[model samples]
Target: MTPNAASPLPPPAERRRLRESGSLTQDQLAKRLGIPSRTVNAWESGRTTPRGRKRKSYAALLAELSRSAAKVTVSLEKRPAAPEPAPAAAPLTPAQTFDALYAFCAPALVRQAYLLCGQRELARESVERAFQLAWQRWPEVAVDRDPAGWVRASAYEYALSPWHRFRPSHRHPEPPPPDADDRALMDVLLKLPPPYRRTLLLYDGVGLDLPETAAETEASTPATAGRLLHARETIARRLPELADPSVLHRRLAELASVERLNAPRPPAVRTGGERRSRFWTRAAIAFTVALIGTTTFTLRTAPTHYEAPVPAGVQVQGVPPRVALGPLSEAETQLRTKLRQAAAHGPERLLPVFR
Candidate 1:
């Protein structure tokens, strides 16, 4: 193809037509290209152009589309003209789109998250948080180049966050014990670095193809493949029995089985009601804090009357002239007032007292 004959990037309409001719949706094309559906949409909407590697992928996809179209044209020329195709169905609303994606993708995501974190509850939490984020940004996520990949990446990140380590983890129901070899493999897997482990899980455990794995991991295809190979080699070095591809595949299958058996059920989809409930719960907490703060400020500022102790044998004449213990020394009075304030407020508010 002449350089000028094929533009560096095809026009938006041509891209959209190519995808439609292939009977591929934006999400489908994104998955094939290891990109997000939103990227596909942006390219087709003339909002952005693919660059570098993506530009090359785009050109190749267009070429493939052209070849396929030519084949269809030749086949049609050999046969009678067909009836006109029907109009496409209307696009789904955001709610419908999210619900469809959730139903289709949540279970697999939970399993993937489980493999990453090794805790059933944490996996579920990660997937739920990811979906919640997706729901909040549905407009963008829905149009994403690979919606499932977008959510899966989010879930993976959530599972890896240091914060989850501090959260309590619920015990998962134990699966049937693994055989000796499986046990050994599990031990080795746990020792792998998180990136290698996650790549191995996505490619082998979850059965994602290299491109899909790359998209989920936010790595290029070559990078993801390298990680997978490194993980396998690492396993092989540690477990000589797995050096054989057949043995390694068997070990991977066993590991995948363990993940499937132990995977937590996907959490319920987040709804507006839950968000509202959370908002009210936060509001109640804020109100309680404000009330406590106001009460403490009032108490600290309230006047306190201090009575001086009379010394033994120090009686005065007629009415025992009231002896105000020489007004407490300036420093002592301030210290006493600060102590009261500290008691009324929290110790954290006692800078003056410490000074």
Candidate 2:
């Protein structure tokens, strides 16, 4: 039997040709697609496939680019051909890969989580959990084309879990007393839909390039750009001071920096041993409960004896009323018999002399 070879979806050559036809570099195409430049490179190099919705979107985008290219064929004829993509980098050691990633990305991910969850502890928990998962699956993650992106996506998902919403300890942190304009901007930003808010945060707050922002938000570059634009316009209407894009970006960066600085230390990652210990602890509790239940049921169904209580004033008789006491010995019995005989015979002739 032979192993199956992995093939790129939508075909790598076609993707490259479509991108080249549009006179777009890998970075430019990545921005348009709302993904990382590395991701675009992977697609063109046949290292991976675009699946699900991404696959459909990639196909549609490629077709559109091709059509647009056809309309301007004359103008594009003089451009130089794109160079062939380089080969994939060798895989990094799991420890080195994970350590580097954690050092570089932990703070940013924590801030992102905090912004989404609005609770200090929950945000830290979300980032810790994400990193723990990445560590556990280091073999896969270390080799992944975009490990940072993978971690970011995982952290975002964890932060958005519904469990966080209902937690008793979850509470919004108090903002530093802001001036009127800052307060208004915050109010409007908080009201924006999650997608727009996240897009703006990644683009402006984190200073990610358009393509990187899209990659983080799982949106296309164009869509991410549109979201950023809309969010800015919305903010501008509420606070005219942020009307300039540069001012808004700077403000967002400052806010993100503050959040990062204020974020609590990341929670300790649970080791495999710790996770096993937790599982066993829970199992022991469950077993104890079951044992108690079975014992209680057995006791409830067991037969019991009941006795009647005596009446308050009634004297109970032990022996029958007509019955006489028995003699204590054989001699006593014989003597009593003789005495009775004598009494029967002498009843007529009884003359008594007292002594």
| Best of the candidates, TM-score | 1
Q: What are the per-residue Cα lDDT tens digits for candidate 2 across 1-355?
A: 2212332234678789888878898768767777656567667877667776666677778878878978788666756677567798988765665667777898877876766655557777777778888877777987799888888888878877767656666655546325564455566776888788778777666556777778777788899889989988898888888887667766764554554434333233536424855788999999999999999999998867775787689666885687687757988889888877874345677656699
Model 1 lDDT tens row, 1-355? 2333344756789889988999998869988998756567778887677776778888899889979998998988887567678799998777777778888888767766766666667777777878888887878997788898888888889887767555445443434235776667767876788888888877666556677778777899899989989998998898887776545655665555565523232334556435855898999999999999999999999878876887679646689665777768999999998877764456566354553
| TM-score of each model, paired residue for residue | 0.51, 0.48
How high is the CA lDDT of each candidate model? 0.74, 0.71
**How big is the positional error of residue 124 in model 1, measured in Å on the Cα after superposition?**
3.2
Name the best candidate (by lDDT).
1
lDDT of 2 at 253: 48
What is the alpha-carbon lDDT for the whole of candidate 1? 0.74
Q: Supply the global lDDT for candidate 2.
A: 0.71
Counted clashes in each candidate structure: 9, 2
